[model samples]
Target: MSKPKENIFDFKLFKRLFEYIKPYKLVFYSLIVLVILLAAFSAATPYLTKYAIDNSIITREEKDFLFYIVMMLGILVVSTVFQLLFIYYATWLGQNLVVDVRIKLFNHLLRFKMKYYDNSSVGVLITRAVTDMERIADIFGQGLFMIVRDLLTMAVVFGVMIYLNLKLSLIVFAMLPLLLYATRLFQKYMKKAFEEVRTEVSNLNSFVQERLTGMKILQLFTRENIEYDNFKAINERHKKGWLKTVWYNSIFFPIAELSASITIGLVAWYGGLNVVLNEGGVSQGDLVAFIMFIPMLFRPLRQIADKFNTLQMGMVAATRVFKVIDTTSQIDDHGTYIAENFEGAISFDKVYFNYVEDETVLKGISFDVEAGETIAIVGATGAGKSTIINLLSRFYEIKSGMITVDGIDIKDVTLASLRTQIAVVLQDVFLFADTIMNNITLNHPEITEAQVYQAAKDIGIHDFIMSLPNGYQYNVKERGVMLSSGQRQLISFLRAYVTNPSILVLDEATSSVDSYSEQLIQNATDKITKGRTSIVIAHRLATIQKADQIIVMDAGEIVEKGTHDELLKKENGYYKNLYEVQFLKEHVA
Candidate 1:
C-alpha cells in the first residue's frame, strides 16, 4: 500500500523550535562563537603549513620552522579548550530545553477534557512525550552544532583557496551545483523513508501496549499463539521500514564521498600542471595548501546533507507532539455560577443525549429527586441507566435539555464546583499504584487517619486491610491488581465515603463484590446516605427494593417508575416483570 504524503520539513516549525532556546540564549550564542573560532583555526592550519614549507624549510631557517610548529600546537590547545566548553554548554542547554518542552506539553495535556483522553491512544501519547522529544533534543545539541562548524570551515577554506590560486579554485567550484542537485534528490527520498519508519514505530508501540494490557484475556482464552503471530507481523513491518531508511542513507554517503574524491584529484592535477608550465605557476607550498583545502570544502557538503536528514526526522516527531498540544477540548467550562453549599436536589428536564450523532441514548428523560432522597435506576444493558449518571456527573453534556442541581442549570456552574459536590463509585474501579491510604483519601487529602480507618471500618474492609503485611500502608499495584475484585470494590467504596460528597452515585459498584462485601457496602451505604441524595444503578433487583423511588428504564426512556409496591401492583409494568423474574431465579437456585 502507498503511504500518505506529508509536507516537507517546515522552516516555520524550526523558527518556533529556536524560540525554546531563547532562555539559554547566552550559552547558545557562546557556543556559536566558539564554533566559528574553531572553524577559523582549522582553516588556518593549511596556511601555517604553507608558510613553514615556503619561508622556513625551503630557506633552511630551522628556527622559523620550529616557531611555526609551536604556534600550531598552541592553536590546537585553544581549539580543544573551546570545543570542550561548547559541548558542555550545548548539552546543558539541550537538556534544559527538553525539560521545558515536556513540562509545557504535559501541563497542556492535563488541562484537556476527559474526551480528549478517551479518543487518543495511551501508547502514542506517551511516545510523543518521551521518544519524540528526545529526537528533537539530539537535533539541537549535536546535529545543529556540527552543521554550523562544518559550514564555516568550508567557507573559509574555499575563500583562502581562491586567494592563493584562483584557477584551481574555480575548477573545484564547478562541482558545487552537482553536489546541490544530488543532496536535494537524496533528501526527498530519505525523508519519506524516515517518516514511514516513525509511523511504523508508533504502530508497533500501540500493538505492544495493547497486548501487554490484555495479556490476561489472551491467556484465559488460550490465544497466546495467535497474539504472537500478530505481534511478529507488526515487528517485521517496523524492521522493514527502518531497513529502507538505512538503505537510502547508505547509498547517499558513498556518492558524496566519490564526489569529494573527484574534486581533490582535479585540484592536484591542475595545480601540478600550472607549476610545471610556469604560467603564473603555483609554488609547491601553494599546491599543498590547495590540496588541503579541497577536503575541507567537500566535507561540509556531506555534513550538511546528513544534518538535513536529522532535521527531517525531528520535524516529523514535532508535528505529532504539536498535534496533541493543539487539540481543542470539546467540553468547555464557561459557567459563571458558583455554589458555596449545595442542597443536593437534582432535576432532569426533557434531557436528551447521544454518543453517536442521530442515535439517541437518552430520550427526553425527566426526573426529580428531592434532597436526601434515594433513587434506584434499573434497566437492562444499553437502557440509558449509566447515561443518566454520566450526564449528572457532567462527564458528558446533555444534547437537548437542562440538568439542574440546587435549582441552577448544571451548564451555569463550573465543572470543578459541580463535581466536588458529587461522589461516584463505578463498576470498573480505577486505583493508582500507591499506598491504600492515598487511594482512599484522593479527593480529601486532609482527612485524618482516624477518619480513614473509620471509613474503611464502615465499609467492612478494615479488618482485611489490617491483616495485610502493611495494613493501610499496603501497596496497591497497577489498577489494584494485587487485590481481588471484591477487595478493590470495597476500597472504592471507602474512597467515596472519605470524600463526604453531598450527592452519591453508585453504578454497579457492588455488583462485582462477594456476598460478604455486598453486605458491608450496604451497611456503609445506609450510614453514608443518611442525609445525602443518592442515585443507584444496579442489575440486582433486591438491592433497590427499599429505595424511596425505583425508575425502570427501557430503550431510551423511563417505561415505569414508582415505589416497589406501586410498580408490583400494576400487572403489565416493566419493573413488576423484572422483579418477578429475579425472585423466581433466586428461589430456583
Candidate 2:
C-alpha cells in the first residue's frame, strides 16, 4: 500500500516519453494543428452567436439574419470536421506509439541475464509490457494533447468575453479563485489515489496470473478456500483504490457545477439590469453572448482537473515501464568472436560461482572435456550438478575463474555464436503450442520438413510422431500437455537432434519418463551422442555405465572422477555408493 517515491509530474520522464513520438512527428504536428483549429472554432461559435443576435436578430433584417444563420451552420460543420480528424489521428498515434514501446521492452527483456528472471515475477513484467504501455499511449491520446486543447479553448473564450463586455467578464472572473482552490485540492488527493490504483492493478494482475498458472497445485493441496479469501482481500483493496478517486471526483464536479451556475446567474442579473435601465452600455446581444461564454470558459476549468489526473496516472505508469527498460541486468555481448566451426572442447577452470553473494554453488570446480567425448555427471540433489549446465551456457557470469570452449574464452565469443554451438534438453521440456514440425525446428528458416523428419528418424522418434492424430503437424498445446511425458521427451530429443549442435547437454532428461520411454531415450541417446561432445546429468546410474568418464560431485566440489567400472572398483567410492543405492531402488520397484 506504500506509494512510489517518484514525482508523478516529473518533466524529465515526460521528456523521455516524448522521444517515442519522433517517428510519428509528422502525425503529431498535424494533430496539434487540428487541436488548435478545433479550439478556435469552438470559441468562434459563441462569438458568432453574439454577432448574429446584435447585427440581425434584433434589427428586423431578414436578409442579415439568414446570412448570419448560414454562417453559424458553416462554422459548426467545419468544427465537426476538425473534431473528427483530431479524434481519429490521436487514436492512431496512441496505438502506434505503444506498439513501438512494447517491442522495445520485449527486445530488452530477451537480452536480460537469467539472474534477472530468477528474481523477477512474470506477472509484473506482463503488466508492464501490456497495461503500462496502454497508459503511456493515453499520454498522447487523452492526457497531454487533450489538456492542451481544453486550455487553449478556455483562453480563446475568455479573450472574446473580455472583448465584448469587460463588466460581464469581470463578474465571471470573480468566481475563479474559489473554483481554482477546489480543483487544487481535488488534484492533490486524486493523484495519490491514482498511484494507489495503478499499484493495486499491477498486484491484482500478478496475483491472478500466478494463481491461474498454479491452479493445479492449489487444487491438489486443497487450499482453494484460503487462496480465494486472499484474492477477495486483494480485490477489496483494488476496489477501494478506485472508489477513493471516485469520491474526489464526486465532490469536485458538483462544486464546479455550482460555481458555473453562480457565475451565470450573476452575469444575467447584472447585464439584464444594465440593459433594462438603459444606464450602462449592456446590449441584449452582449448579455446573451455573456450567458453563452460563461459555460464555455468554465467548461475547461471543470474538466481540466480530471485531465491532469489522467496525465498523472500516465506518468506513474511510464515510471514503472521505464524502470524496467533502464535495467542493466543483461549479459555483455561485446565479444566479436564467432565460432563458426566450434569443436566443442569445453573446459571449466577453477570456477567459482554463486547466485547469491557469499553462497557459492560451485567452488573452485575444474574439469575438461576433449572434443567428441561424452561425460556423465552424477550427484545428490543440490550438489551443483545442474549449476554446471547453467554456467556452461553462460546464463550467469561466474564470480571468478573461467569457462572456455575449444580453447577460446567463452566471454570472448558472442552469445549467439556460443549458444548456437550448444543444444540443451532440460528435464522439464517446454514445447510451444505449435505443430510438432515447428517445435522441432523452432521455425528455423534453414530447417526444412524433410530435414526434421530425417533428424527424428535418426533419433527413433519419427514413427512415433507420424502416428499422432495429425502426425508432425499436430499441435502439442501449451507446454506439450497434449502429449504424454515420454512423448514430450522424445519431441525434445528430436528438437535437439535436428539442431546438430557441436555440444549436446541432457540435464535430467530421462529422470521422469517411464521404462518404455527410457528405453527409447537410451536408443536415441546412444545414436545422438555417438562421436559428439555431450554431457549427461542423471539420477539413474545404470544408464551411464557406458559413459567415457563419470564425475561424482558432493556439495560444491567434485569428490571422484573415473569410468563407471573404474569408479565402482574403488571401495567406498562416491559413485559406487550412489550406483548401489539406485540399483537397489530399481530392483525394489
Candidate 3:
C-alpha cells in the first residue's frame, strides 16, 4: 500500500534549498548588494521627479531645470546598468545551483538499492530529477532574488514617502492589512492546489510512460478505449488541479487591486484637503511624490505576493527532490575486496529468499560450483531459477543464509568488485541504439577497438558483422531492433567476453534464437566458458545435457541434482519427465 499523503511556509524546505546556493555564495551575496543598490536607485527616482517639479519645472528656473534633467538621466542610466547585471548574475546563479542539485540528486539515486526502483515509478523519478528540478531552478532564477529586490524596494520607497509627508504615507499603509490578508488566503489555497497539480503530473506521466513502452500489448489486446478512458480521467484531474489555482487567482488579484486603488483614492481625497487649507504645508512636489510612492510601495507588495507562488512551487518541488535525496535504503559498498582476481568458485549455503514476506521464492536451497565448472539450473516457471541467478549477482538481497565466491563471503566484498568479476547474459538481451562496436565494448575507456574486434573474431561473429553496411559501425537502432534475436544474443556474448569476468551467467540466453544464431551462440559459449565458471538457466534440456552438474528445481526446492544420464536413469525422476515433456516434443516436431 502507498503511504497516504502540507502547510505552507516550510522553513526547513527553504533552508535545504538555500544550501544549494551556498557553493555560489560570492555571486549570491554580490547579487543581494546589487539589489540593495538597485533599490536605493529606484527610491531616488521619485525624489528626482519631486525636485524637478518644485525647484525647476514650476518655478521656471532654467539652470535648475537643466541640472535636474541631467541628474535624473544619470540615475536612469545607473539603474538600467544595475538591472542588467542583476538579470545576468541571478540566472547564472540559478543555473549553477540546479546543475549542482541535479548532479547531487542523480548521484544520490545511483546508491539506492534495487528495491527502491522496483517499487517506484520511472515517471515519478523523472519528475523529481527533471521537472521538479526545473521548478527549483525557477525559485532561484525568478523568485528569491526578485523577492529580495521587491522587499528592499518597498522598504526604501516607504521610507522616502514618510520623509516627504508622514500623514499621507500612514494613510497609504492603512490599506496594507487588507492586501496582506488577501495574499495570505491566496497562499493557503494555492499550496493545496499546486500540490494536487504536482501529484496529477506524476500520475499522468507514469500512465503515459507505461502505455508508450507497452504499446504493442495495448494494440494487440485492443485496450485503446479502456486506456483512453483511464487517461481521460487522469487528465481531467490535472485540469481540475490547475482550475483550482485559477479560481484562487481570480479571487485574490481583484482584492489586491481594490486594496491598492483604495490607498491611491485615499491619498487623492485627503491630500486635497491638506492642500486646500494649507494645513500641513504640503508642496505640489510633496503631494506628487507621495502619490507615486503609494503604488511603488504597494505594487511591490502585490508583485511579491505573486512571486510567492513561484517560491511555493519551488518549495514543493524541493520537498519532493529532497525526499529522494534523503532516502536511506542503500546497498552498502564498504567491503575491502577490490576484485584482485576472481576464481569463480560459487556457493549458496542454506539460502532463503522472497520478494515479499511469507512468500518464499528460494526455500532453503543450496548449491556449489567449483572453479572453472559449469552449472545448469532447470526449473518450472516461478520455481526460483532466475531468482537464484539474481542472488548470485546480488541484484536482490536474500532473506537468510549466505552466498560466497572463491571462499570469500560475497557480502564482505564491495559491490563494484563483486559485480565486475561476473557477467550476465539474460534471455531477453538488451542493446542500446548505437553502433555494434559501442554495444560490444560499451565504450569502456580501457577496452580498445582492437580488443573488441579480436573478441568478435574469436566468437566467429566477425564475418557476420563485416557483412553489414558499415560492419561493426552499423547502428542497431532501438534495443537492437535492426538485428535478429540471435544477433543480439551474440552481441551480449561478445560483451560478456570483452569484460573477461571470472563468472559468466547466461539466463536462458539461447531460448528464443534461431537455429543459425543458436549455433553461433553455442560456439561463443564454448569459447568464453573455457576456463571460467558459468551458470546456465534454461528450459532447453538439450542445452544443459553436457553440464558438469544439473540442478532441477520444483516449487522453490532442489528436487534433483546429478549428471544428465544419471538423472534420466531414474524411471520416475523429475528431470526425466520434464525432458520427455519439453525436449522430446521439440525433437519429434
Query: Residue by residue across 126-239, what tens digits does model 2's lDDT show?
Result: 989998888888887888888889999988888888899888889999999999999888877888898899899999999999999889899999999999999999999999
Please identify which of the two predictions, 2 or 3, would achieve the higher lDDT against the true structure: 2
TM-score of each: 0.94, 0.97, 0.96
Misplaced by over 4 Å in model 1 are 1-7, 275-280, 443-445, 448-450, 587-589
RMSD of each: 2.7, 2.1, 2.5
List model 1 lDDT by residue over 418-437, tens digit each.
88889899999999999899
lDDT of 2 at 179: 94
Return the candidate ranking by TM-score, descending.
2, 3, 1
Against the true structure, candidate 2 reaches a TM-score of 0.97
Candidate 2: list runs displaced more than 4 Å: 1-8, 587-589
For candidate 1, the TM-score is: 0.94
lDDT of each: 0.84, 0.88, 0.87
In model 1, where is the ten-residue run with the lowest total lDDT?
A: 580-589
